[model samples]
Target: MPTETSSLELVGVLDELTPEKEKYSDALKAAGEGFVEAYNIFQDADFVTKKGWKSELSKDDATVHSKNLSFGHVFALRTTLPVPIDIAFRESFLNFDDLATWSENITFSKTIAKLTDHVDVVHYANPDVAVVQSREFLVARIWRKVDDDIYVSARSVKLEHVPTAKGRTRGHLHLGCARFSPDPTDANKTTIDYLLSIDLKGLIPKAIVNLTMAKIILKDFTETKKHYANVLASENAQTHELEHHGV
Candidate 1:
């Protein structure tokens, strides 16, 4: 598994939106949709051609070459829970295979097919490394490394439901590991040292195409974060009141 580390220290009310285990389970579905949308943008012929990514694929066999490309993207999302929240609840969602599937009619590419064929899903839940599922599958496992360690893996699929308040939702998928570091000072305000690396095999050298796709994924997450933040704010206020009253 490929790994990179970065620190992210969330501030303001954001710091209190600690994720429960169930939240990760819910987010997995949303993350999957984000991943798919991002992949489509990356694979668009016009977008690829305009950005010079087409050159990476064999001109004589664009489909074959494109099909063999190893490009993959992963996303790690973290939210801080209030002090009173149970960590066990948060860890429950670490088992990757528990994610909900948004659709049964989804199609995958050859490259994705190959990776899933060898994919494994394991979580550090206890004495046993729970193997939720294995074999070639579109979405890999969800994992929570030992005590704030970096979690790395790749996945492809959308499982989480998007909030209705966000308006009509778009399909987006996330295929990457979740890295968590106990330290602060990471680039993305992540408490757990984390890195969402995207393998730019066929898309490398096509800087424009790669960047455009990256922007789409980042933007989607940015908006998603806004929605999460809004929800968190309300929750935090309620919790604070309960705490003040010793509830």
Candidate 2:
């Protein structure tokens, strides 16, 4: 019952609403390269140790590792979460903006631009902890899925449209990547490998930065695990109640 012109107008509206497929394609390519490099570094046992990646903390199934690079420090963590890969990937990357609500370490987070379904520009700020100063980062992120595994990579990028927030030191994230894969042994679990290279540009001492960084990564994973566990519990409870009522 729609007129030809009305249908055309509707198509135009949908076009505007949908992100351009080719937008930020070059950035996505670069991020892919970075991801490959990070994956290689993390997988190379010798290279990781050569880079001074020492085991900082090992608790339960989670292990945190750290190393010092010339430009900044790098941290890596591996853990298994009691959630499916798709849900873990969505919560960690697609729902990144929602992280501020559940993450106390991050005070502010906003997606500056979504270049495509797989690429975006984000700005997030972390509150000051101990001797560390308040810091913010503007990053370009790219994510992709291979088979059942999902990989996401991000790095600092300068965009004229997104200006620096006042009263916050802009930090440089050389590279950040997270890989989510279904645990082969457990169908309901996902294994995550998180690697990040960052330099909090300020007068903060290296010791303080390293300590805080380690704590932040560990806490982030723990919080994410706890959040999903609670969500699944609540969902199961609701489903049970509905089943009892024959809904």
Candidate 3:
């Protein structure tokens, strides 16, 4: 949501909001545990493309891999964006309320509650794909800076405020994490690693689910890369205008 390089300020806001921990203890705990689990998965080289993972999609420098887990099949994607890490972090993690505007797969997204500056209770829906039914998620999301990288983690949580909508199946997000880091070689580039596992709780066929899951994720990240490029171009144009006007 921030237009400037203010990720550190976001971290400060997280620290200042620590006093409210007691109020949202359950949600925070669930979200934090999800973060830790996701971080471990991201750090495990064997859990990624190297070991049991089967390559699902790989094109234009974006790659997705899948492996069977106890809860569901998990998908991990890695890609580089032509935008800085801060911008990628803001758009992908902080600005979820506006996700459906640019993301084609998501039909709607809303921030039900802001537990903290870095944590939120969010609800979002995806339209039916192929034989899969429309699915929705009620999740607790938290994002923070760890070391020099930014991580956003989300896990499904039951809340009275969010109930399943008519004709839509609820999806349990076992674990979802997105990591954003500087590309090292280019200041204007960022590398992102994403991991997700979800169980759509309904009478859907496993064959169809598996067939469509990887393609959906591939489209999601491909759209994300394009959206980030557009955002960066728009920002640069605005900066150029300001400089031309000597503002």
Candidate 4:
């Protein structure tokens, strides 16, 4: 009994689809490109999700199938910074209390907040249901130290829902936590692992959901993984210099 008209609007809309699926392949490609660009800009940024409802076409009278459009998948990626156990304990423990300070001082925190705001604006303009959710501070519940390495786990969530006719819904839900630990084998190294499980439901096709999920994960993983690598490299370089100087 939902409206028949398309209630969802994509932040980045696809051009006209050709009758021939092959000819319309470009649409999918374009969507992929745009997703990557937007995702990179907003990932790790702090933001909020806003929700509301509006009327659309009556479901009973509509003839256009909702399947023809593309709504991207949902995913999550996390970065773990390697800190000495003592430092980790201090940082993780103080994260909550220092959240305000972190937001004011950390460059990444500011970047994340900006990204979330951008996503909100984009989603609002496009009209599809989209949300950006982030924790003010990293939550550390699980901590393990193997050899010289230390591992810590944290959690967060993001959800997007787009309602359609035919009792179908298209959206993305990303959940799970990330684990970060020092590299036992490397004295100057750290390892980070991010695990995210995805769930999609409603009248949407399984195939489409699966594909979008993959794309979302791929984009997020790549960007976050790269960020971690950069942080590790910087830490390693600093550690080496200190040793050389006998600090």
Candidate 5:
């Protein structure tokens, strides 16, 4: 049973949270329009601009085409959070075992094998993709913690040999990882860069893939920005409450 005073305090916290949301949205809008290109390395397909999050999309065979083969580079930023670098690195990128804790896109993840202390071979399923009238499959990503960032390299693993209404197919490996480090200007804030160089493989329509390519690519980073904003806002609110109560 909560008291009226506590309820009033909760409402006040929401008030603080709402304004922070607006601030974070503005920051992300600016980031999408600026500082996006600093993450791009691939010359041809790198479409990332400072306009939030971006990805370059293409197919191996455009004509006589199948959605089975497509590859590109993706760049996204998780910014405007005042969390420390180490915490940001762990929660945003390193903590794969509990990925569903922070990432909305990844619904479930469990460790299939532990290669070492820093590396986790994982098998994850995405129900989000299954509902799209698209070919569904299981993904196995290798998570390795580098010096300052975590590297997540994955390929489509075979859930089944033949294609079925519910079966898996072969996939390829894309070499790149998200890097994390301290912000040069602000010690309290952290910057996150997600660089995905993946060749998405499966059976689907090339036209469909091309049509929704930008949305699919941007989905990863869009979630990242939202998660980042919510994380810091919640933290700031807690800090405010503590000070208000003289705790």
Candidate 6:
């Protein structure tokens, strides 16, 4: 019998080849797709999501590669929870107000003075580490009234790279998007597609980076779901009580 291989070992096999974009050809390598060759090697490999949530991650091969390595990861997770789409959208994606409450690492967060609606620049500080105010994010967020679905696409941004904060590691997330859609068959079911594409353009090994990403996401998968479920249930009970009293 074949030894049960881990995802990291499979990814290590992929780390051997180097991208030779200079000698690019459609057969050897494509022009527009960044790091396509790297991600393409694991196209068939099986991956486990946070809490076994059945997320599928695939590369979006069309967009031009911005970083040295070019690729985009497309991930989708579908669940039939006993909650309406609007509630799901609010609790899952639009819960910025409750973000610090739900996430254990987030010490502080603030919305930047914006020039327009639906675009938010959020600054995040992680106090667990010795350094203060460690991370920041630039996001474009929306809640569509027509479909009652919520969508957000975000990318990480850095102000002045703090060299003194050696304890803090520089992480890279090239692209990310989230989509919350309602299930057509049932009014109470919903599906969330959280997609990302990361090719860390640094000295760190891709396998290690991959491992870290998986762990952080896995932590969120269980915690976020439970938090939302409880909050929604409480709100629902209040709504029912008010309706019964004719309020």
lDDT (CA) for every model shown? 0.31, 0.74, 0.79, 0.32, 0.42, 0.42
lDDT (C-alpha) at residue 85 in model 2: 85
TM-scores for every candidate against the unseen true structure: 0.33, 0.81, 0.88, 0.31, 0.52, 0.56
Better of 4 and 5 by TM-score: 5
lDDT of 2 by residue, 1-247 (tens): 4322211111112111133434444454455556666766656775434456688776667878887665456789987788988778877789989989887778888987776556677899988877787789988787766667777888887766678899888988888888888999888899888888788887777778888787778777887887788767887999999999999
Model 2 Cα RMSD, 1 decimal: 7.6
| Candidate 4 overall lDDT versus native | 0.32
Decreasing lDDT order of the candidates: 3, 2, 6, 5, 4, 1
Candidate 1 regions with alpha-carbon error over 4 angstroms: 1-137, 150-152, 156-175, 184-189, 192-208, 244-246
- Tens digit per residue, CA lDDT, model 6, 1-247: 2122201112122111123311111211111122223234223233213332233232221111112222444333334456677787666555665677777645444553221233333444444322122433332232223245555444554434222234444444454445566778887776654445544344656545454344444444555567768878899899999999999
Off by over 4 Å in 5: 1-83, 127-173, 205-207, 210-213, 243-247
Model 5: per-residue lDDT, tens digit, 1-247?
A: 3332211111112111133233222222222222222223312242224333322442221111112213454433333456677666656545666866666565555654433333333454433443243323233333434454333333443333223334543233242344455677877775554443334465556544444433444455556556766777888899999999999
Which of the numbered candidates is closest to the native, going by highest lDDT? 3
Residue range 1-247, candidate 1, lDDT tens digits: 1111111111111111123333333234333333344434433574334432222221121111122124443222233322112222233223223322211111211221111211232211101011211112234333323443434344444324412112222222234443444434443233321123343222225454344334433332343334335545777899999999999
Give the poorly placed runs of model 2, Cα more than 4 Å off.
1-30, 45-52, 58-60, 69-72
Which portions of model 4 miss their true places by more than 4 Å? 1-174, 200-202, 232-247
Weakest ten-residue segment in model 1 by summed lDDT: 7-16
- In model 2, what is the error at residue 45, expressed in angstroms? 4.5
Model with the higher lDDT, candidate 3 or 6 = 3
TM-score of 2: 0.81
User: Which model is ahead, 2 or 4, in terms of TM-score?
Assistant: 2
Clash counts for all predictions: 38, 0, 0, 7, 7, 3
Which model is ahead, 4 or 6, in terms of TM-score? Answer: 6
